[model samples]
Target chain A: MTYCVALKLDRGLVMMSDTRTNAGLDNISTFRKMHVWEKPGERVLTLMTAGNLATTQAVISILDERMKAPEEREPSIFAAPSMFQVARIVADTLREVIGRQADSGQKADAAFNATVLLGGQIAGGPVRLFLIYPEGNFIEASDDTPFFQIGETKYGRPILVRAFERTMSFEAAVKLLVVSFDSTIKANLSVGMPLDVALYEEGSLSLGTPWRMEANDAYYRTISEGWGDALKQAFDRLPDMELPTSG
Target chain B: MTYCVALKLDRGLVMMSDTRTNAGLDNISTFRKMHVWEKPGERVLTLMTAGNLATTQAVISILDERMKAPEEREPSIFAAPSMFQVARIVADTLREVIGRQADSGQKADAAFNATVLLGGQIAGGPVRLFLIYPEGNFIEASDDTPFFQIGETKYGRPILVRAFERTMSFEAAVKLLVVSFDSTIKANLSVGMPLDVALYEEGSLSLGTPWRMEANDAYYRTISEGWGDALKQAFDRLPDMELPTSG
Candidate 1:
């Protein structure tokens, strides 16, 4: 299982993904789930995927191959005119890879099962965030639901539901997201450390210096400790029940 | 869907369950998930069920019938020698009812799925909690894992993971459980308001007045508001990321 989350705020976009993938309990390994496509001041597109690793890798590999081809007629993430077209290219590539894998009998039940969080800004348009589904379709985040999460979502849902607001400051949004991720990592063993975090400032068509956070990263450690201590203090402050005495 | 949690602490036990049952998104109804069997000083047992409503109700009816039949050989909740035995009885009854129903060919794919949380103290035993599986086998909570939750459990798991301690005060335990329930209800529509809360003090052999909490109840409203505000405040206090800019 994987956990990836993205928030699109007025300041910019914040994306985080865990680096744990497992075929089974004994076959656990680390795999970065975030992919970045950058062309300096032209476009910067970040993709975070959750689902079967093989299928996602295939889709990424196909996109990379297209980018490297000298013929250059095929539309690549680098050449997409708008963020919407970039999303369409990614979805279509995913669907094609899934169809090919399904045609071959090598993969039986593991047909393409991947959801992508696509967030970035083009040179001219606004910064946008989308949740692309497995069937090659997508939905943009609205004011009602300001963020999107994929995989192992429930454990971290309370924090998002309670703290996420459209008007929230970017600093508050990032802190809340880290706390949410901390809660998920504590409850589930399938999601581990060494997180991939990327931030894209609005109107800047280049990625923020991405942070590769390990288990001992100081900010994460502080968030974990502070959140735990705050919860305990809050628990202590709730009013105690007044039990009725037996006459 | 449902959310039921029971905790065994030094002071006593706390059990809470939401009352919403939904067949589908459009077909939702309210049915109490908690059932209590008490014989004053002899024994007091509280059972909370989650999963298929029909199967859970059938098992409960079977258990009730066993209590009415004085000639029955095996012990029922009222007559069990220990809380452990009571859990086994509940699990076995659930399994028997499910098996009988499935054999009748009324449903396919084992529609007989339900889990039960049984917690209470017998006259001579220590306060205990058990989580009974659909197969009629159960596991008792220990010092390591001193609580059991069934139904939509993930949404409320973070609070218990952070706040629960074996020596927690009864008042603290009840309030923590209520806050946890509020979190679950907020995140999942299938688990809703009007909760059933029961507290059993050590050596009391009978439950305290069970609180039927409605959406507008003063204490519950306080918890909902206080918890949300506390979380937001905590989120705002966490330090923000210090990004490294490319020179």
Candidate 2:
């Protein structure tokens, strides 16, 4: 299991994902789920994956392989002309990977399915966010839905829906996501740290280096503990339930 | 779909459920999910249902019917000598309902399954809480796991986990659940107002009249709005994410 989130803010893009993955309670390992591709002064792309690890890894590897052989007829994510095209490439790669798994005798839909969150900016295109599903279809975030969350999304979603603001400062966006991730990590054993977070300024055509937040990171600790305390305080301040005499 | 939560606190028990049920988005309807059977000063039991409406209503009808036939051979819920026995009766009723459906050519497990939250105090037993699955098995809440949430539970879970304290006042518990329910309602269309909440004080041998929280309820508004503001405030106060210079 994994938990990944990306926000398309007015000022830029903020993406975050946890590194922990597990096949079962007894088999746990750490693997980076967030990837970046940068072409300074031209474009920047970020990808966060969830669902089947094999499928996601295969998709990433194929995209990376295509990038190396520029003369290839196939499309690579880096070669996409627009963010939409980038999403299409990622979705196609995901489909191809799943298809291969099915050819190898695995259940294509259940065993090899993967979902990806793609966010980036092309040289001439505006910043965009898309959630690519297992079927090679995707949905772009809009003004009404300015963010995308995948993998164990429900535990962390209430806080995001309650707190997210498209116009908030990038720093606040990062803080909000950290808190949301923290909430998820605490509630479910499947999603853990160190968490990877990236901040990309719109139209800069450059990807910000990602930050890895370990379990003991200062900000992580503050958000985890502080959010708990703040919640209790908030609960205490709420007015009491006033059931009338008959009810 | 529905959202129901039951908390086993040191002071007593808090149970809540939303009434919305739907076959499809267009076929949504309101149906009470919380049922109360209180024999004043003798015992109090609240049954909250989730899953297929037909299965739950069938189970409830059977139980209610058995109660009327005092000379019946079957063990009725009201006749149960202990809370454990009560849980067994409820589970047995659920299994019976499903089994009957299967015998009538329905896909019992898929089409007729219903999960129930059975909680109450019997005359001789301590305040007890149990989550009865469709398979006629059940698990009671313990000190470690003092709560059970069924249906659309994930969205409201984080707040409960963060704020739930066994020693907290009953009013606080009620407030916490309202906020949790409010969060779930905002994020999910299938779970909505009016919400039902019931309180049981240990040893009271009686149940409080349940409160019905409607869409425009003042307290619900306060929580829906107040919680959002409080979360933003908390996020704002968190120390900024100290991403490395490159991030």
RMSD of 1: 2.0
Chain B TM-score for the candidates in order? 0.95, 0.97
Q: Who wins the lDDT comparison?
A: 2
Q: What is the TM-score of chain A in candidate 1?
A: 0.93
Docking class of 2: medium
Predicted model with the maximum DockQ = 2
Model 1: per-residue Cα lDDT at residue B127? 84
State every prediction's TM-score relative to the real structure: 0.95, 0.97
lDDT (Cα, tens digit) per residue for candidate 2, span A1-247:
8999999899889999999989889999999999999989988999999988988988889889999998999987778899999998899889888877878865546867889999999998899999999989999999999999999999899888888889987778888998899889988999998999899989788876787889998878887888888877777777876655222
lDDT of 2: 0.88
lDDT by residue for model 1 (B102-198), tens: 7887767365689999888888888888999888898999988989999999999999999999888777777898889999888889999899888
